[model samples]
Target: MLAGIKSAFNNNYVSAEDQGARPLIANRTAAKGWETFDVVTNADGTISFLSAANRKYVTADLNDHTKLIARAATIQAWEKFRRIDRGNGKFALQAVANDLFVCADMNLGGVLYANRPAASGWEEFTITALSSPNPGTPDSQPSTGFVVTEQQFNQIFPSRNRFYTYAGLVAATAAYPAFAKTGGHAVERQEAAAFLANIHHETGGLYHIVEANKANYNHYFDYNSKYKVVPGKQYYGRGPLQISWNYNYGAAGEALGLPLLSNPDLVAQDPAVAMKTALWFWNTQTGAGTMTCHQAMVQSKGFGETIRTINGALECNRGGGGAVPNRVEQYKKICAMLGVDPGGHLSC
Candidate 1:
């Protein structure tokens, strides 16, 4: 489905009426920025067909042989092709780049296809009817799940990457019970990963501690900050996870048996503090208290929504913080990459 969509957008196919004819050759010298899909140059002034998946390259030479680029061991026999209309003014053509069947859109510049990585020219074909190893539905989506196998877990934990290990996960689970669980599909891991990915993207990385050498090393807030309006000594960056706002710091400090009001910065440095702060945020469900825009999206849409929200937020704010864009062309690319509906949030 994705390949066909990409192929259509790339203009890689021919109609039934134009049977056995070749596609127009690309005049561009560099393959880096071909405007349409599969718009590759051929040696004899011909062109090669590229797919959206970047697989199955076809050429007019060798009598238009259809061969898999990766394997190159098998050749598809030439056969007569047909076209079938799929309603909505769209047509499904047969024998695409390498005689593959496809239902695609006509190429339009700066459209959805123009935003994809393969937009620089590639051939794509619909192979949904093909069988697979699992044999249930084609699961082409790249899983963003942080749930790693034992071997995978061992590879990431107890070291510089400890932030993703079970130890790091424990704090997140303890702080945000609803979001983080001990077992399978813990919403905590998802939310934490989303949070971490966001902050990392915002501030550089997890190890980029803002208050690395403060007397109150555990807190995240700068007590000496010129903008400090709060009175308490620890009212800077309280709680554990997000170490939210000033008022919430006092409230969380009182609830969690800490001087969160006196030294808030602790949360950003300590994994335990960060976890607790995050928990408080989820538990209270207030923007000032604990909940965030990201949390809201997580509750409503899931990880993808959270990431999209963050992406939009970053793009709109240019790092200054503001309203996020509801629609972005890259979002469609991401949705297509994930094999999900790009029009709305996920059902879960």
Candidate 2:
């Protein structure tokens, strides 16, 4: 459910119009069946707004000035939005097709358009959760657990490689039941945000599947560690958090019951295995810090500590160059999307 926030159209709710080829409009005085929409979180981490009135997906028609219409039968790029939370109980929908904000154009009789360059009064909308007995239906609200929905994940990393999938991340959570479920709701959300922020930093907004500099590919081998490096394997950075080194691969492989030390490419090839290796480090390893990343958030040690645990040697203190600030900024952005306070001690 979305209601317009433009001064003159504050009371109007988005309506699918009269089905058929009619475009969505923001002139409905009351949010009834036609005004209600199902916020569908897709498996690929994008979101689709399904009109409850006609059971059709809303689409940003690129051929029609990106006018929003409720005529799509299936979810596609044009049907998806990167929902942006404004931290004031309002949000703006950015079309996945054009990376433009959806605007309720008052000058055009409150017609919805995905042509706005930025979110403002005409692009802001308030969402209301409607109660429903059937939880799987489109009208049901999103779950409170984990906090990062597939849609939000897609929103955070719009340009992420297809390999770093949201489904893989969810499946990897099965390995560590307490990964993001340890603390209360807010803590859970913070922990998720912190981990993803670090991952975003490491993978360059999830665009890289492996380390970019090929020169560093063979430099992560450690001979003194208990886990022996395989004869021909190279344990360079891979996956969301870029699990690196021979010992780390050996340990992660042993824990996840995979031949990661020898078949290190699995971390880069298999999405679930890649995510599992990252989670293995988050829940278990302390790296240069004294506590695991999980322990940092669950114990309210702040997001800074998580960064310390992950790469304190290179990125903590004032040694990080721009890395630390980038991670903190990403964390704050994710927290804003989740509607949670990015607690103090933001930087190391």
Candidate 3:
């Protein structure tokens, strides 16, 4: 049920895909460090987990498999992903006719699917040998397992590792100009990793539900409440990534090739538009070329600095609503994820 770490083996069964796994389960006789919890691709284009030290595969029965269940519910295109028990005590992944493998799951009616393209980070798994965990009665879409042990899950799943990551401000910024110019300042790899980090924190490893407790803080702000739409007031939040505020909404709409809306509610209804709006805000409004949200943090020592700057310019804070404090908290949390001292450090 759980796992322990073990020493590296002299076995030559290791393949290119079997490399770089952190030991999740601890082994009593094994050393403290060795390659253990590994990720690899299957022939069917789905990801496979490997446990190097124990030489056992992680397989789940169809009833116990959460990932496949979720995929089956949403994407009809996944009718083919079957879980087959390899006779030698392993499982093989296979797809159905006219169906393909998607690397990501859906959130809010949107699914981030991937294909076998090098640019999209797709890799092909080479099966030197055949093995099976379940025999004759394999499900059309069978359950799969991590080749990892319990120790590996404890060690690797808790932190920002390759096992989990997602798109957020970082992805929006890097992929588009609006976010990159203002708040989305991370370079290619950094931005990619950060986006995944933010999404990981938001959705818990990219496959879980967007927790209600963590939703708004990670999502775009204004769309959470629909009853607050005032005639001339700023509608700040909306969408999966939660792009907020009148200025951001308007600007993001233009960048994403959607119609401009001063209201945040519009973002939530159109899922693709919501993503576009987020990208718009991150790329143009928050980076170096424009308002520079991160730079403002360097100057004023917190997110409060950017809020105050926006308030001063927009006159929206005329009522003294106290958005600065909230901004400071969000900014601090993001900084902490990067392992930076929010109060002590001025330069990022």
- Give the best candidate by TM-score: 2
Model 3 agreement with the true structure over 1-348: per-residue lDDT tens digits = 112212122111221122222212212232211222223233344433333333333322133321222111111223234434444433334433223332222231211222312211111112222232223212211122211123322332354333222323223334454221222222221232233333333334333322244444333435444333345544434443344544565556555655545445555554344445544543345532235443443333433333433333443244544443443444344332222234432122
Of candidate 1, the 10-residue stretch with the lowest lDDT total is: 67-76
Off by over 4 Å in 2: 1-146, 319-321
List model 1 lDDT by residue over 1-348, tens digit each: 222122333433221111112232222222221212223222222322333222223322224233212111111222112334544434433443344442222342212111122221233332222122122222222132223223323422223224433455454544455553332222333443444434433333333334333465335454454435355444433222334445566666666677655666666556666656555654454442123434654464543454443343345325423323322333333222221223344211
TM-score of 3: 0.31
lDDT ranking from best candidate downward: 2, 1, 3
- Candidate number with the higher TM-score (1 or 2): 2
What ranking of all candidate models by TM-score puts the best one first? Answer: 2, 1, 3
Residue pairs with clashing backbones, model 2: none
Instruction: Report the backbone clash tally of model 2.
Output: 0
Instruction: Give lDDT per model, in order.
Output: 0.35, 0.80, 0.33
RMSD, one per candidate, in order: 14.8, 9.1, 19.0
Looking at candidate 3, the ten consecutive residues that score lowest on lDDT are 66-75
**How many residue pairs clash (N, CA or C atoms closer than 3 angstroms) in each of the candidate models, in the order given?**
38, 0, 57
Span of ten consecutive residues with least summed lDDT in model 2: 133-142
